[model samples]
Target: MAEISAVSEGPRTEGDDYRGIMRFAHLVRADLPEPALAVLDGSQAILVSTLYPDAPATLQELIAGGSAALDAVRAAIADGAAVVHELTDFTFASAVLAPPAVLAVGLNYAAHSSELGLKTDAAPTVFTLWPNSLTGHGQTTSWPRSLSESVDYEAELGVLIGTAAKDVSEEDALDHVWGYTVVNDITARDIQFAEAQWSRCKSFDGFTPTGPVVVTADEIADPQDLHIWTNVDGHMVQDASTNQMVRSVRTLIAHLSQSLTLLPGTLISTGSPGGAGYSRDPQIFLRDRSTVTVGIDGIGELTTHCRILG
Candidate 1:
């Protein structure tokens, strides 16, 4: 089994209650006859099949039991009948990993806003992350150190929507969530501070490292009550609570759904809490050989090794 950790809970699904959600800390690669949706729990990679191999991998698979697939897998897991495998030899890919769009929020935390010297918008500051940037776990994310030695990391709670939402009420917004994942919103801080646009700085190839795994929505009772943190090398650099978020996850979704259709399989990187490297007294950028990991109390910790080329 790869390392596993627990975090706080988000709201439970109506009529269906569960214990805390469990996410995989290791990478999962499937070797099957057809396209498959599988989750690695402990030492097993449980297969989740939708309509058929050719059927598209939709958010519904996981969200609507497609996302909830883990639930069934866990039943077998409890019975000691899981299909456990040695991941040491398997290649890995991003979890839920491929989504319709990756949306990120900016300055949702007061501390982050102050550190970046930016004013919070009366409405939420939202941006998109390109798909080309998605990378698997334990991968080296590098850039020209010259691109901006000010590279930083933002530990954020990533929400994977389960259903299509449009003009949703905050109370009902979370119902559309399939599960949650952690996101290292790795950033080029200098570019972030300099550009009016946010996508480019945050969307550099390999900047977003998501998943070790995705925990179902039913498992989390309250998304607002988790502890999020980051460590560089061995030092704790960023630490804060999800409760500090200016707008709760529900609120952010409600707001976004108002202007755009919040499609199923959308990955929303909620803003990070304070303690970004660029805002430190002496400043702490991700240096060569730097190993940075970001985690939420119940979700999982996402680690990325950094390499800066001159």
Candidate 2:
């Protein structure tokens, strides 16, 4: 794994003094065709490419460049390279616009498993989410009513791997993590229950929404301690801590690495906690025009608007 430099410890301020150590991605305009990597300093965003013309254009590129590339970005920030924009000036793209794969873990949270009448498996229930499903914060996600009306919301913590790993130990698994983000693992409950497989039901276009921003792993002291929650149509639907995972992030990474080489920029959506809409007493499914927001305490919140088309 690339060595992450120590970020200055202090309260983040506005203007130039802003901390540039934490990297995020956003589209400067809604019309912009691609996401640009930026250094988030307070309410401002400094475009990495703009600060240094030779800098990487996307997060994937930056990660591919390793620690030295990141160090260059930090150095540019510290030197006060003046081109900065207010965060409000741009809209967000998925924090992870592109990745090697989007791997989701299921039955990794006992509460979620028990509530859904499913048993915790001896091995992690893993599934792939198609790339077409990926969307950004504040974007509207729609599905046809004919697809089945039982669409549900799941608030999960997303983990991004910075380095490839093969047969890594749980004790050293976290070293490969690049950062963390929030994920709204939207699901078509009816399809999910009906099918023997999970990917298609959950991989519908726009079903997996991620990020307002991705915070580097160095910023997070303990992934297990973060508070994760979800709100749908203004009501708190799912609230839990990362501590509830049946398999810790470290355990999941290590376990996964045992089977295959986990590539850099791979996104792992750790299982959601209990309180999924599918398991609610009255059953709270996402309805037409509904809005949902999933958030983690330190990481930014991700919101998605829903449109149920006939």
Candidate 3:
């Protein structure tokens, strides 16, 4: 299993600073198109566009060069030598395929808890989602009717750790994040009520749909101030603020790090807000052909098409 980790080779010397490094390294000869981080079948590749056609660079091959690989991709964009291809032209796999573990939270919102007839726990309710549950953007996710007719959606903000974090303070937690993305924490409400554990119901195949894109940490000034919402079949279902979170991102990280070693590339899907389909006035479960989109004000919107199987 390949994971994205920091290459600890020491910082680049003066001669390798941003501007000087560009001169020292090879640059893309012409402007072809924008580049994307994509996976072809199972291997990671750089999705680049050329006048002739589209191309991909194995992520393993790119990372082999360390920082130089990122510089190459940047140079390719700066040179305008690549052609832009519609991303829809390709299929996708989970963004981070072998992430150490997928940590999820529950009952973080008061309303969601009340609606489900569950009380808020004094401590944060945390659990794990198996790696096999991940699906990609624009993909159709199906659930077994016998397993759950109460499958519901939870709009959440997903955080990707960039460094090994242990016993970090709240002030320092954000510093360890690589980037942020949107995740739909689709839940099987029936299983949630029947089982004491959450991992199974939530870890069914294709239970977690993440991404459209990951916005680098630098792009977000305040992670806790974003607006998070959800739409079911073109109707808005959830509308709330990240500020309403029972536990802020920094605090959650600091708290989690105190007990476990958070490795680089670890994905933490923060708990979702209220207005879930399972607890609606009429009770709205994701039906076959239902389209659900969970969005964070600045991060991005993630849409998933649902399917129910007999």
Candidate 4:
């Protein structure tokens, strides 16, 4: 089993009340054909499928099921009907599996934009990360050494939508959010600069590592106030706040919904902050056996091991 950790949970509200924030993850073991969605209880997990026969099997299903499904799961927990599983018994799957899409915003932070010599366009610098790149915490991510020796690490905040929004107002934007998770938007710097677009360079297999757990949106007081940072091989590199984003989360959602509907289970990786390894005096890129951890305070942390295959 890979190392997994869960944040401390708070008091559960009364029956059928889904107001209380809950942490969720997708757990996998050899016996289970598919990943099982579980509610994190400290370091242990209670499989949501075991909570009720109709409960969702994956995080995507749960998001699509809406509030009624969440209420039922909470009701089951409050009833003490949960069957707990040890965290050590299974490794993690991506917090989000088969999301409708993985939308990524680039250069949302002025510092990051400045550091990379890119300008934050009047509209957000948005792109897509292929689903093939999505992996989970404590997983090993590898790429051919020939691809690039300049791969970089970016720590970002990831938001999951619970409802569809075609053209929502900024004020109503946050309501569509289901939860938040940490994302390490691993990038191949050389390919990224050489390419006309960002998709291919960053979409290599196992490049995007998301979640040990997803902390419900309600638990996060102000997305802008949280602390987000990165540590590469045990050394602090990137450190900043969501406050620095050129556009807020609600702004991004509202802006995105204008052109196309932001569907349920869609993950919006809200871009990274200032300290990219690329901008450091002596650029620090991920190497074989390197461990990189990206975290959002009170939200969650994700760790990815790196390998440069010949």
- Each prediction's total of clashing residue pairs, residues at least 3 apart in sequence or on different chains, is 17, 0, 12, 0
Q: Show model 2 residue runs off by greater than 4 Å.
A: 1-15, 18-21, 28-31, 87-89
TM-score of each predicted structure versus truth = 0.83, 0.92, 0.78, 0.94
Residues 131-153, model 1: lDDT tens digits: 97887556788899678888899
lDDT of each: 0.75, 0.84, 0.70, 0.88
In candidate 1, how many Å is residue 1 off? Answer: 15
C-alpha positional error of residue 282 in candidate 4 after TM-score superposition, expressed in Å: 0.5
Q: What is the C-alpha RMSD, rounded to one decimal, of candidate 1? A: 6.0
Which candidate wins on lDDT?
A: 4
What candidate 3 gets wrong by more than 4 Å, as runs, is 1-72, 86-88
lDDT digits (tens) for residues 212-240 of candidate 3: 55655766889889999999998999999
Best TM-score goes to which candidate? 4
Residue pairs in clash, model 2: none
- Count backbone overlaps in model 4: 0
Candidates 1 and 2 compared: the better one by lDDT is 2
